[model samples]
Target: MKILVPLKRVADPDNANKVKVNAGKIETTGLEWKPNPFDEYAVETALRLTENGANPKARLGEVVVVTFGPKETESTLRQALATGADKAIRIDATDDQLDGDVVARALKALVEKEKPDVVLAGKQAVDGDSNQVGQLLAEYLGWPQATFAGSIKSEDDKSLLVGREVDGGTINVRVGLPAVVSVDLRIVAPTSVSSKHSPAHKYPEGVRFAALMAIMAAKKKPLTEMKLADLVSDAALKITYTGFELPPARKAGIKVASVPELVEKLKSEAKVL
Candidate 1:
């Protein structure tokens, strides 16, 4: 199985408190960059699917990571490579040139060229939170898709059994090969990705840390660069960022001396009752 995973770089989610709104856009200066958390789960899913149990260093198939961004984004791809992806591809494009639709179109082009058996990506990127690219890419390719997959297993060489997260409970479905899957948080669980060599084998929860050796080896891994314009043209963005504003701050809470006073405050000042 040749699996393709899309990686994205986003401002560190942990430092969300530091993010600020500027005149009409988000101010990201001095903020750290890291792979989208959900996308990291996608990468871990792909790596687990291709891992060979008999030999830790050997893989049954390839896991290729792709991303669309400027030169700096290559660091993100390198991180995925360090985690065991076979190779990396960076689509040269600026942040201004990319939106959900443009990204979907570019990925569609890569899908056609690579002919991967499966395309796994995050359910959404934290930065935009659009949650549209994977479905759009599947539509653009005329391929089946399973979104918000919590658990996944190869039903056979040509199909996958996916456990999807819904409102009330999980729904299991079988999707054919050459499909697209957008993963959610549970996908990073130890036993989420089934292994062919050992059906019961479990990976450690969360994305694996790249060892010093692996980090050094990643430098030797093949990373191919492609021009976004060459792959897909007419990528006119369908949406534009008009402006940004911080949500209204919360008011301070008041303390009440007793239940009656609290009820009076609720019915009068608060007016809830």
Candidate 2:
């Protein structure tokens, strides 16, 4: 089966965060970029599904990785490729514009063109903490969606058995071919640098092109783009920023010599147990 996985670029978790004022709006800056942690889980899930000769009933075909971000995001795809993705496609665009709706629309276009049997994405992106894109893309394609999937298995050669982690327990659901699955961290662990599989090299020139041309060329590689005008539900989501405030600075706490003094301070001034 042809599998499609959408990856995301997010702020490196180890870096300190800062807000930049762009036209009176707060924009995140001063941070290094890394693949969203959840997407790594999704990718690992996909890889695990095909590994160990698990899908022997029907030979697993290929894993295609897709991502939407600035040109630098290709590095994230390279990481995925090293991790075992058969090939990679990147939609070169400004990192800020990759919202739920825009990314869903773009992915819908790509899915229509590629016609993959399964599409996988992270439960949410860490940078925006928005979990809407996978569901939105599934809605756009009129495909069944399973979110926060804990485990995915092939029911037969034609259907997918998906396990979703719910509040109290897990729910088992099945979807026919050509469905979307968003994975939670419980699905799998992040792929390390060494476990990556090397992909066969394709034409370098077509692979490395300018941003504008790269997007144009992405259309040729099993991608289709649709405007909100063409969607039925127009259910694509938008994030609105209203205001921003800096967190209040914290004051240093005084050290106490004994447990009694700490208890007294907490009871009198701090008002804690």
Separately for all candidates shown, the number of backbone clashes (residues 3 or more apart, or on different chains) is 0, 3
Q: Candidate 1: lDDT over CA atoms?
A: 0.89
Candidate 1 — worst ten consecutive residues by lDDT sum? 51-60
**TM-score for every candidate vs. truth?**
0.93, 0.71
Would you list the C-alpha lDDT of every candidate in the order shown? 0.89, 0.68
Would you give me the overall lDDT of model 2? Answer: 0.68
Segments in model 1 whose C-alpha atoms lie over 4 Å from true places:
254-273
Q: Judging by TM-score against the true structure, name the best candidate.
A: 1
lDDT of 1 by residue, 8-71 (tens): 9999999877779999799989989999999999988887788764455787788999999889
TM-score result, candidate 1: 0.93
Which tens-of-lDDT digit does each residue in 90-190 have in candidate 2? Answer: 77666445468878887888888778888989999885687998999999899999888876666543777777988999998988878999987666522
Which candidate number would show the highest lDDT if scored against the true structure? 1
